[model samples]
Target chain A: MKYTILFGARSYEHEISIVSAVVLKDILKERIQYFIFIDSKGDFYLIPQDKMNAKTFSTGGYEKYPKLQMTKGGFLQKSFLKEQFLGVEVMLNLIHGSEGEEGIISSLCEFYHIPYIGPRIEASVMSFSKELTKLYAQSRGVKMLPYHILDKQTRNIDSIPFEFPFIVKPLHLGSSIGIQIIRDKKEMNYNLDVAFEFDNKVLIEPFIGGIKEYNLAGCKVKKQGEEHWIFSMIEEPKKGELLDFNKKYLDFSRTEKTTQAEIDTKWTERMQMAFKALYHHCFEGALIRCDFFIHKDAIYLNEINPIPGSLAHYLFSDSFVSVLDALAQRLPIAHSPQVRYLFLSEIQYAKGK
Target chain B: MKYTILFGARSYEHEISIVSAVVLKDILKERIQYFIFIDSKGDFYLIPQDKMNAKTFSTGGYEKYPKLQMTKGGFLQKSFLKEQFLGVEVMLNLIHGSEGEEGIISSLCEFYHIPYIGPRIEASVMSFSKELTKLYAQSRGVKMLPYHILDKQTRNIDSIPFEFPFIVKPLHLGSSIGIQIIRDKKEMNYNLDVAFEFDNKVLIEPFIGGIKEYNLAGCKVKKQGEEHWIFSMIEEPKKGELLDFNKKYLDFSRTEKTTQAEIDTKWTERMQMAFKALYHHCFEGALIRCDFFIHKDAIYLNEINPIPGSLAHYLFSDSFVSVLDALAQRLPIAHSPQVRYLFLSEIQYAKGK
Candidate 1:
């Protein structure tokens, strides 16, 4: 069946999306007809994944490629794209950050009646904004650091109640684009200015010190009886002093120290509870990585990554489920029902008319 | 500039959007080259407003009419849509309810670098979801009716912690689509079932009896070298019973009542404070109408229409500024500096490459 991999968003994680899409193409190559959406200059191109091997899908090289245009001139005007993608079966979304995580694409997919692998629009929007996500999490009794939201016009940084050694980050940006750790009030202005460079709103949360960062990646799949089955978790031990953008991405030429930390039954149960709480709260579909900080023997959820790096295959590798098997299971579960409904609804409407 | 009036969404207010867009066409025609985005069979058609006039942009007739496919291929192809919306200078979003009010169109415009005349995406999403909006409002000390949220899996409606004569409404749907007044436990299941027809989640709020409904429409515009200026307030006097969807738009057809109502200075000041608070919290561009119920001396905010009916021009008609003047002021403010920055950044990155 024809399939498309949506990637390369107009977001800070656009480059990361390209990498994820490329890796996904390698895995899904034998199974489906895959294409990458490389967003450049606010335009999207349906480029073969093989072509993306030569250059990175970034804003710089975006305009160099030709893109599919939806024109008012009807099918005859842009029949090629219609012929190529209309025949396709499913969409594998590899987009991250802003619109990717905020349910715009999900809504569009719903409008189009296409089957996609990931959270629905409602869950996407709830998870995308840090403020909204935290609020929902708080309502669900999830322990989180106290945060003070600062808007663009916020003038008095000194008057902020949150003491220094606070985490300052954009409310909406992903991949740690405008995240800073302010050590003192003197550094607050600098950090706030830096955070404002990326977004209009900043979330200032009290830094949870004396904690080891843990990256727990797992896949939540729905079985026949409406039961959710969560796979074994993969824990990533935090390397060095802090896990900033470079450290998170291992971009600073540092060989990242990643180990599969053993989870006891008690901690495993706690992790499961957290996952279920988040899943029930509104997350759905495929693999999601939940980042947590353990301080004083308590696990506090940092944030949830709907679309994690490398599709977080390493987490499932040890459990004997290849990334391909997991993808196969997740994709069909995500796509089939939605696609059938679209066709059925169209037929019903046509008959009614 | 090449522009589009995106309306006729899969919203409860789909019909209202048609009226709003049709009326707005007259105001925007001279300055912008616009087309109406008619949603038919889950795809968007960029039809000229003139064509829409000949054939009403209703769901039934939309499929029969020729339309511009917004995507090159079917919905799954992200690249297909990336090409279609290119060069569209502005989008005047008139669609209300789920697709419009929930920030889907706003986020898409932001991702596609298309300027839109409405609230920012974050604010729109926050305001659209009744549960989240009320929670946010409550956090900010906004006066609202005591309510309980009921999810789809909620069993035993009689067990809810609310008194009789409560209003049950689908949490996200706008225009009071599935709103029902439940006088007692007998009506609980019927009301919930009716609300479930529109949405999966429902809100049960205490019905404010013997209260007059008011509509306060205001616009936020930025003048050169100054902060944003909010225009005068317009209050709709309660004519008959409770203000429902039919009563709202079909008010002209009902028994003729006073077209205008007197706004006491104290109430007007309170209304201004609410509007300003909303503006600071999330609202950015265009005009918005806030519905309120005055019970005795207390004012309870009902819901806010980000893109109110006819842009709430009826409210500005008798004010210091004419409806045309208000539109003129509002149109220019649609050119958001923050949005301009996003466009410029994309363009600059493209040029640099």
Candidate 2:
């Protein structure tokens, strides 16, 4: 079956997506017939080897090349996109922000009636928006910092209810882009300017002080031949100040201390409950990495990466589920003949008499 | 500036979109330059007249249309899209339901860096999802019907803690599609099946015994080159049995009984406050139609349509504001020189070395 790995979108995390797709290609090589790559520039290519080289075609630039382009009048140039998947069975999505996480691909998959693994469009959109996610999380009793939203038209910054030392970021951005820790009113103006550059809406939250951060990566893998799914291990960053983007991604040369942390059984259980609630609330599937800050023995959810980096393979230790097993377990069933028939019928009916 | 009118999508309200785009074309003909039409089959065409003519496009059938061809590597062609919106400046979206209302187009607009007139992506998605909208409305003290979400994997439908005589619908569908009023277990099975067809998630709400429907159409209009915006008139649908899809759209032939109803001025004041709260909460602009049912003199919000049918132009009557004037007020502001420079600089930075 032909396998496609969609990556590198028009988002701040586009590079991260490329890195993720490369890593995933290595892991899924033998399991799938062929891997197709899509990059941030709206290009599609094929991964020739373990180390995929990005290239450009007349249609677009892609790593693992695919011949397809959405043309001027909304016409599908069949010759370009109708490549038999060479038994291509599934799409491994490595897109991070924007259209990737917010359900564009999901809707396209639905429209094309293809089986893709990830959160449905609704959940992805809700989770992608910090305001929406915070609202849902707060309603579900998930711990979050008290925050207020400010629009571009907002005139009086003095009226902001939150106290100083607040953190501000674009309401709909990821990868900590446009994040600013405003220490006073002097910095507020500068920070707001930076935040507004990324988006029209800005979110200001009172900074949570003095808390250790942890990355809990897990795949909601349905047990082999079973209906039940289980959460994987929890990885704690070496105790220190918050790791910025550079430390997290670019500074990989430095052996940043990360180890499996010892969590209290009760705390682990609570985290599991929160994770499950989030999974159900967001209707997310496959791998997810949830970040949380521990303050006074209580865990506060920072954010969720529906399409986590490296497919969060590192989190699944040798003892637990492997990447291959996790992928196999989470792979969605292709559209049944009955479902396909219904879709075709709807399309025909829509054509009108 | 080039202008494109994006209409006709994979929605149940595809025909309604065509009607909307045609009407909008008639109104904006003198105001804008060029108008490109997007048909229901996802093909683009030019609407020669200011009215929709099914005979012109429908005669050829969707598949036989000039643009209907699959590409080589399986991606839709882009030449057709470019030709359709060659000189388009802004997209006046008339698409309704699911992908349209759920933020796919908005996201694409953002990706392409094109300006559009409607609710932004996040708000659109939230407003359409019944469970999320209800939760948000409840949070804002907006009275709403009590409803519970029934997930697909859940067992024991009887365990849901809700009263009988419930109305069930797909969580994120619009136009009253797949909506069913179930009175007992015998009906529950059938309604659930119907709802599940539209979406994987379903919302069940206890039917509000007494129903008096009202349609409040208002737009945030700039008052004569001023910075402040004002809301337009609020029109109440003539009180009667709930208007179904057939009565609302299909039977426009019937004389519309909707007239501005007399009510205490205080009601208008309160409703305005509610509308403003929602506008700020969702960061919405342009026209919005708020549906409400008064039970025991208490207004309970059913839902909000960011892009209501006919742009809810009927509600603007009696008010000094005309639909054309209201639309003119929303014309996109060309970026200031400084702002444009900043935008270009940021894009260059994003382009990276």
Candidate 3:
């Protein structure tokens, strides 16, 4: 089966997506048939194997490749003579933020009926917004840190439940681009202004100093008729006041192996249970990483990476192809709407009579 | 200001979408530059003005038209020699049910940077599933009928809170496609099976026999800098048991005047207020209809039609072009993620130094 590596959409993490795609080329190897890149301007390109390097994209060398067109089943690349189908039987969504996690690729894949390894539309939509993610977590009986969503129109800072020092994050961003630690009331407005520049809404929560954050990546695979989860070893990321954009850039671009965090077995089981509660029926086909904060001996969801950087493959030991194969066979089928139009035809028949 | 009318898709209401598109051709007249149809098979076609009729789609005559390819900014049509851009500045989403209301067109339009008149992804996601819609209503302080969601895995019927003669509806479907009223426990299993055939999840609500249902369609348009709503007259659709797919078939095909429903002005205001609460910050840039059931003097939200058939033009006397023009100008901007990779560059500079 032919696989397509889709990456680099109009996102803040566009460069990170390219890095992930470049890493995937080595991992996917001979199975990849097309390297589809969506530029920051939202144009599609079909990059050759040799042109998969970051320099090719950064230097504008990708312009030499044929521009791809999104058609029914898959993408089409046109030459001087005719159009050719990329024949992508399956797609691996590598774009991290924005279009990748915000339901564009998921919607396109679902509409085109192409089986892909990524969060479905509902999962993507629920996870894209921090406020919505909290709601989803609460709906699934998972604990989340108390937070308040403030938009551009929100004027009452007094309404916030959190006191003195708090953290403000752009509602729909990841990789900690517009996240800021607000120390006092004086810094509140300025930090909110900065966060609002990245997104229309911002999520504010109490800044818990020295909170232990653990990251776990996993996916659910169906075998025969039963489904089970395959979880990766949890890793505790190095942090300061927070892991800002600079620290995350190094984290996003890496493909190296890291040792698993040494944590208690009971905590591990508790975290995995929380992850399962959040993932189970909601995130069926996607490989997702969930960051949890252990504060006051309670696990609270920090955020969900619907398409984690580098697919979070460094954390897992299993072969991605086999897991994706198992998932693809059991993807949630789009509702088969009754297409008979029998009633309409019957009305027409009566009118003719 | 070229406009594209997008209709049809893999939906139960595919025929109704064609009817809606044909009705739009007359109302939109010369403003439309292209009539793009997504067939039941999910293929795209550029239907010419001459072939913009129900017969063209019903008899599969639309195949004679040029096949369209979705490109970066807009759709592209390939001829014998070369491909041509449709140059669509704005689009009106006319497809109903599945692909129309399920975030495909919304995601595509947002991804491609095309200004469109339809529900945005979050709004579509919230309203597409009946369970999510109820949650959204509760979150927004809007009243909704009490319901329980059941999946195929749900074994015990005793878990349901409602009594006999309860309503069973496919969670993700519209137009009453797989909705049934279980008169007793004997019919519950059979109805659940039928509803499950349409969707994996089913929403069960107490059937309020002879409930007075009203539909109100409206849109929020940004005038100058302030956003205000333009609401159509409230409508009372004829219902028998349930407005099944057949009754909705006739209802979906109409392009005529509908009289404003005669009801208490206070009740009408309450319903409109509820609609406002649901649409305000959520469903920006889209024209939507919300169905409400008035039971015992309290207004309860029934469902939201993200893309109402025929655009629900008959409910309003205002010019759609003007309203759409205002909406297109003020469509919610996609989050401009921090594109400057300044942090990454700074890290590289530090390492190089």
Fnat, one value per model: 0.11, 0.07, 0.44
Q: Write the per-residue lDDT of candidate 3 for residues B1-353, one digit (tens) a residue.
A: 65789998888778888778888788778888889998777778988887786556656778888888776678778787777887778888888887888888899888777778899998989999887888788878899988987877864578899888899998888888899999997897888898888887788999988999999998887777887888889999977879988778788878787888899999889988899999977799898999999899799999999998888888876566676666777777766654454543454466673
TM-scores of the models, in the order given: 0.82, 0.77, 0.95
Whole-model lDDT, model 2: 0.61
Give the per-residue lDDT of model 3 (tens digit) for A1-353.
Answer: 66788998888888888878887787768978789998777778999987787567766778888898776678878787977986678788888888999899999888777778899888998999888888888888889999987867865677888887999988888889899999997897888889888877788998888899999988887776777788888999877779888678778767776668999998999999999988876788888999999998899999999899888877875566665566666777666655664544565567673
C-alpha lDDT of all candidate models, in order: 0.62, 0.61, 0.83
What's the candidate order when arranged by decreasing TM-score? 3, 1, 2
Identify the superior model by lDDT, candidate 2 or candidate 3: 3
Looking at model 3, residue B143 earns an lDDT score of 93
lDDT of 2 by residue, B213-232 (tens): 66676655566665344555
Candidate 1 local distance difference test against the native: 0.62
Q: Write the per-residue lDDT of candidate 2 for residues A1-353, one digit (tens) a residue.
A: 34467665556666556556656555556655444444444444544554353222112334234344333311132243342333234665677777678776665555454456665666677678888788888767788767887888764687679888888888877767678889887888888998888777888888866766767766555565555545667777653344555445432222223457787777777777787777754554556778887788788888887777756766665533254455444655322211112322343466683
Docking class of 1: incorrect
Q: What's the C-alpha lDDT at position B226 in model 1? A: 53
CAPRI quality of model 3: medium
Winner by lDDT between candidate 2 and candidate 1: 1
